[model samples]
Target chain A: MLLFFLRVINYKKNNYYYNKIEGTIIFLSNFAPMIEDKNTPKTSLSELGEFGLIEHLTKNFEINQKSTVRGIGDDAAVLDFRDEKCIVTTDLLVEGVHFDLAYMPLKHLGYKAVMVNLSDVYAMNATASQITISIAVSNRFPLEAIEELYEGIYAAAKLYNIDVVGGDTTSSTKGLLISVTAIGHANEHVIVYRDGAKENDLLVVSGDLGAAYLGLQVLNRENEVFKVNPNAQPDLGPYSYLVERQLKPEARKDIKELLAELEVLPTSMIDISDGLSSEVMHLCTQSNVGVNLYEEKIPIDPVVISTCEEFNLNSTTVALNGGEDYELLFTIKQEDFPKIKANPNLTVIGHMLDKKSGMALVTRANERIQLKAQGWNPIKE
Target chain B: MLLFFLRVINYKKNNYYYNKIEGTIIFLSNFAPMIEDKNTPKTSLSELGEFGLIEHLTKNFEINQKSTVRGIGDDAAVLDFRDEKCIVTTDLLVEGVHFDLAYMPLKHLGYKAVMVNLSDVYAMNATASQITISIAVSNRFPLEAIEELYEGIYAAAKLYNIDVVGGDTTSSTKGLLISVTAIGHANEHVIVYRDGAKENDLLVVSGDLGAAYLGLQVLNRENEVFKVNPNAQPDLGPYSYLVERQLKPEARKDIKELLAELEVLPTSMIDISDGLSSEVMHLCTQSNVGVNLYEEKIPIDPVVISTCEEFNLNSTTVALNGGEDYELLFTIKQEDFPKIKANPNLTVIGHMLDKKSGMALVTRANERIQLKAQGWNPIKE
Candidate 1:
């Protein structure tokens, strides 16, 4: 099935590659062109080195967070949290394993890295305030490449309204590695953890799922087709949403605000980074409860379903086990479900059960099957 | 000169390699051997995978910090800083670039990773309360090896009285990469910055310098010898201090406490990760002051001096340009110099001057020479 898509893409490449590329160029010309200096001399990283590269990339970032006492150029960035409790989380992204630079733009990579860490902050019912990004890159990456990467990072920081604080830049032996530490602050009373879920709690999720995974599949297939035929200009309009979800997924930052406005506090919460099934297991184990996940209620997009059919994979399976959704998954009291029932962004997918009941998925046929955590595991070959 | 030392080491190896190893074995037998379960079943990382591995490694880490409210098994670690200001700093350490596993024990690597980041927190005159350590390793590493690495990390967390908050562990494309983020807290009134120095401030450094560099040289030489002949047992007793300085370097955690005890606040402060000259330049540029550094007053351990002489290198040059001392370098008012004069651990080697004057070193020959930041530049080929 994947080979058929590749063949179709290759056929389209031979027939309409140039015209499609021209259309894309015309489309992109509407926006401000990204600054790419072809005439500028390529500076060897050794000339500016680690400290200089850091100073150049981070020089423009202003400390916007009132809690931020100091930003870059210090041993440590200082923040005054006052009476608010602080939340901290870190994520490490390595090339070849976590991302393929061939199709992944450096800018998007930077934005996604920050988003992934910030998603965890939001999952805790906290507002992210600051992040420190430490990157190690090989000599293969020119200073301009690093600048482009930081531009994405700066854009994410601005969009999220967070401060770019202190970080270390060093030389790597091979490939680019980025580690982001996000700091957030929340009131002690509102902070949530995964161990607070109770029986009869309604399992709710924000936004749709499985699009990111299918998007990755589409990109992978397109990349394979391109490898075979370099002139391939695969029509990506149909897969644009999925591709965007894969390359530039956003954290459900507004969900916390919405929940606050609705006066519904989650008993237990986690972000869907490793698929809904895996995250459900984590929540259930931590909260010492079982879950009854309804497969029909799993919010998957129509595009994802079509793509999954084209790939000969089950949409339900993809939605259950596909990772990197970055959506909020939490359990609220059954009585609180009414507050979120009218909201289109959120869906009640399941409900918590007693520990003796065990975690199971109720299918459309009304048959129950045990759930397993087959989420994306990069450790496997 | 290096060849002569290698020849001497080879000659010693030819004569007493086995006997020396036997003696070393006897010496090690006196202490508890590190836990190594080579005979046990080897489990591929794929068996437990990422999440399981994280849970297995971090399960035993008890939260010791009062600031930490929620740790591990959560979207993000939560900390209650109350009214205190929080300090954050992050560092990236790549395998071949920052460390070599041949000589660097994984435990020491873990401990050193924590120390390096905590050093920055101390440089800010704050008390470190928590840290998030993210590591990426290639498949070549076994589950046991990762356990050993975390053992060192757990040891450091215990010794420092800090909580292990949260971090990500992922698979790297090639070598190991560790990024650590240290979070600290300090009263708003006592925090220091690098831009606060004024004219006539006394420049002081904690402990001696260049020992870490010399230690690296020793390790590199020993590694080269081992590569040529694995059985060779080079006598390291004479260079033990240097080797320790490199392998198990400690952050000057006591400096902040000592300064508090003496009631002297640093006008400007920075850590000597990059050699003294580079850090001095940072202070001068940030603080808008020049400095007159007395070469004769620069502290050097007797072992470091002898090692430099043996290597046919200038002790003053080594002290000035060598990096990774992890020592605090700061300036204090001239009036406060008397308070630290009797402290053996602190050495006042320079005094701040007006911006009109240039940064210079007064040599032993009574000649003044402009200082250069010829520190360790790993980016250079």
Candidate 2:
């Protein structure tokens, strides 16, 4: 019976024909097979009750954030964000809708989920200090799977100078769903809002765009190829930059520090999540301003350009409408432009206009086009 | 075509045949049918973009919390929870596993979702001030359905004096899932924890128990009957109290203020989400004490006892094993008992013992039984 159990566990791991039974796997845009590395042993989540599961998963997480009065192992996390203004953001990532586990590893998914919430925190120019993660998983997942997920969360928590304060664990009926809430703080004077931009503020963005979205496209393409030919191991060396951006996005935790060092504060800020156009419009609309977004000045990674060309796609459009680039987009005073002009990480993509001027995208051909919030809408898709 | 759409939607609302297609619906324990009232007009979620949906749903929410600097329509909600200690708790509720919409109204589900998080906040003897709700729903739901959900959430927030701070709206591949993060604040001196109980402290609980669990059973039973006979309108008159306890459970928000009025500080506090025995065990284990829970002293609603008899189940067993009773359980110094003795809402269940004695239930027949934490485990079930 012990030998039989071993064989069954091992067989469960390497079930090549698991796709037939994984019909419920929900990936956005396509149906992807649920696949995982099959070398490890499995422990059903049933072995541990909810409290025990939370305790086990969170035992390794060290509570180092000074603002965190108490971390896990309590009914609620206690935080002391004295004097500074507190900011909160939350997002729910349903399996298949917000994430596709077929291509996204459990660990990466965990890390990315944290990154997603932290991005919003940083968008407020706040120092992210604490986060609470709650997840619901079906019994199909083993204890090891959740452990891996928490490991990623711990990794993010450690690197980001944040504490995992509190969370909940429960069973889902279908697949895995993760909800992450990030809490951050900023001195009232330094905090930026999307409604602060004045006319003629310099529109700037950190890092690059289009890479994360293209990375997803590459992953999906590779996934499809593997679906058709399971033996194929396509080279991913060239698309590493894009794939990394998609699978393991790092929220711009350093941007606030960088701006502080330069003695420049943003007039208005928003994160580039639902594509550049969508976020840009939100910023300008809220600021009671418009923007002239220069197509030629929009930052795009070299790999994104080459990958777009290879896929017969437009890099400009990808940069405009492809979301999931966890980069900060903000407007600085024109006087501060000189301070950030030489910075390699910053790009002046556009300048703000008066609200009556209406938002527009300045094409490379010098044609003006109105901004549309046609970002990725899961419902529409 | 318009008529066809209406027919489809109206049929969808009262979907008798919908059960066959809803095999993926994941309710905890037994399978429950997907049922809904049929009079409302349906608007596809696809009609509104994600941001638009959030804006529309939150349009009516008034930002009444003084700490709220900025509510929705931003990357994050800004607050000013200064000198007071801030508390945060979160929970993820998945469709089917955590709820069955067949008997649970969308509005009630939304209200209960908020209450679940608030219960944890109040457990700390804090004032729940803000909440961020993130939900992922499939296209199978209409915009009106989501609106109904938000209405319930709005009602809860209004009554609880909480500001709907920030959240994310996204599409799910399967059924609906909601994640709520509640933020509360308290003076450091007044905040209660789960590790402060003394050996001689009096163990107490607010309100009654077992009704919520019995309510679920009643709903599931009625669901089965409705499945067998589409026209069987369940006359829930007798089970009204149980049904209300199950469906629209009010978190013990008043208990904290009431305790203050009574001038009794609970040494250790925990909310009873699970059964009485399970929570009692948790309180004891965390506090490093043992408990002598008098079975007869355990508060049970008269209706709950009658319903248990009707279902041919032991009331004590149900009170010990049945979960989802959102009552406040705490321990206070023996000197505080007289202050709370005459309170109708509060009941002294038992007393704490030394850790060496272990936890036990003293039955009416004078038999001592070790407390078993056999509360609901969705994964195991």
Candidate 3:
């Protein structure tokens, strides 16, 4: 049943090249994406390290909220409550399920833990002011290791300028688990939820996509190469932007501010942590509308294009279904579009459609195609 | 190292009983004292099932705040910000490390999760009003399992009249993890911290102690029996109260209200989740004062006595070191103690001493022994 859904989405790409040895049969078909090639091997979490991964993951996130005092750059995220409107959101990250410590560092794990929660608060169009982090670890983690996790937490808190007010810490017999509850405040009118889009609204994205997905590919390929030859060092040349997107992605706090400065309010909004298609589908479904996205208008970073071509993958498909972008995907009225178009960072991707039209992608050739979401379905994999 | 601490606490007792007809060997220990054994053993969480477990776990939790217009028994906890002071607290629970799920039910787990945090807020002489829960789980669990966990959560919310404002959910590679953050409110003047105790302050406790720990021991014994012989039914005759204390515990919300009604303010306070000794020590250490606990004055339920006799454990030691009673341990001025003592439910077990004298336990024989914390240490076995 899970496979049927995957096939229906048609987002899965089977064959891909590893950027490593220019030419080498590293491995064959499996659900996992290729991260590296033959010459460049994968590195352990301890080697590539925490900061490196964070830098790799969050480079392209566009800030969307003026109230987001701090985004992924801090310890606890900082948010300026508008009119004392309380910000509320929840996040759940499973071990082995969401992360593989074999390739991820504990400190980064802790850092990412805070980032994910902050992302949700930002999605609500509210500045993340305070967060309560909860973690359950198995006996495998030592006291010192737990302390290391907290160090990252404290660091993030310091960076974000949010209080580490309270959280629950318990033991689990199985694996490590973390859950964070983030709270922020905003004006009752300024806060955006998922249910406000209307027909003819312009769809806008804060930043480019597919870089994080590609980064994961690079890491996986490198991992395969290292398994074949442990002595080989990873040569992650020229793909730093893509690589960073996967390890430490950021939440867009700036674009949110820009929109406010322009006096433009999003009709509806959600962060693209899953995939563009999935997030767009969410906006449409929640708002009881449809959408038409122009393929030509979708922004693709040059690095993503080059990498896609090198790997024999369609850059469009990568942008459409690739996950972990953490960019803001929002819609605004037509009148607001002109005001935002002047901003170099904002991209008008498409427009909301009437419910009867359903959701579709309009190619540069003017050919219309149905837009289906192939989200990051970890369970299916 | 862990064993050294356990031995020092000296609460350990082992008993071997041979049931001729059943041809079974049973090992028992006495740890908690407040609960009725028979009532507790019959309704193990497993027997009641997950949803049943939650209902059973939160049956006794009381709400004391007007702002907490709602609590543990809801889809999302609700709160009314009716000009009341707000206070918040959170705690985390880990598997294997913090609890042996072997004897702990999912419902009880949920109940305990909320109680622990609520207890913290109660310690501050605050009324708990809202809570946010976060959970991380491994794929080893089915969606139904997660629902079961939430069932327990909802049960607690409803029971306590706390609104479930927000939380996070994610997957874990290893074990099940739950983190609960509770928000409470109280008049500014009424809020109590651990450092408020003064010399000659009377130490008082709400309700009896030690049953939860003893309840854990009974469950462990039954589990051992079932593990050895899958076909054998658990022989939990006449130990219900103790088992319930271990499985489904309640927070002391009532005491907060009662204190307010009597017009008595506690000088210092903390909840007894980490055993009376540890809490007492905390009050002394934080307040820079000494304490002398009269052992004979400590309250013990009748069931605790019979269980202690049956298990060959000293009831006093069990009451001292057993944890998770969810009762409030607090200090009041000498004048206020008379007001509190007039209430039958309150027990004045000890009084604050000078800092130079340190913490001590006054035995019935009039001998004073230095007190040390030998409570449940999750880090140690």
Rank order (by DockQ, best first): 1, 2, 3
Residue lDDT tens for model 3, A244-351: 566556566666677788999888888887789988988898798989999999888899999998888988888999988888889999998789887766889999
Q: Whole-model lDDT, candidate 1?
A: 0.83
Among all windows of ten consecutive residues in candidate 2 chain B, which has the lowest summed lDDT?
B1-10
Clash tally for model 3: 97
Tens digit of per-residue lDDT, candidate 2, span A1-381: 010000101112111110011111123233222233466567778887777787899888898888999888778999998999989999877787777776776777898899999999999999999999989888878888788788779888988888898888888878888889999999999999999999999999988899888988987887787678755655666776677678778898878888999999999999998899999999988999989999999988788988999999999899999999988999999999889988877899999999999999999999999988777876687
Model 2, B270-295: lDDT tens digits are 99887888889889999999989999
CA displacement after TM-score superposition, residue A58 of candidate 3 (Å): 25
The residue pairs that clash in candidate 2, if any, are A26-A96, B26-B96, B27-B96
Error of 3 at B352 (Å): 1.8
Give model 3's docking category: incorrect
Note the DockQ of each predicted structure: 0.68, 0.63, 0.21
What ranking emerges by lDDT with the best candidate at the front? 1, 2, 3
Candidate 3, B359: how far from true, in Å? Answer: 1.8
Question: What would the C-alpha RMSD of candidate 2 be, to one decimal place?
Answer: 8.5
Ranking by TM-score: 1, 2, 3
Residue A381, candidate 2: alpha-carbon lDDT: 76
- Report the first chain's TM-score for all candidates: 0.90, 0.90, 0.77
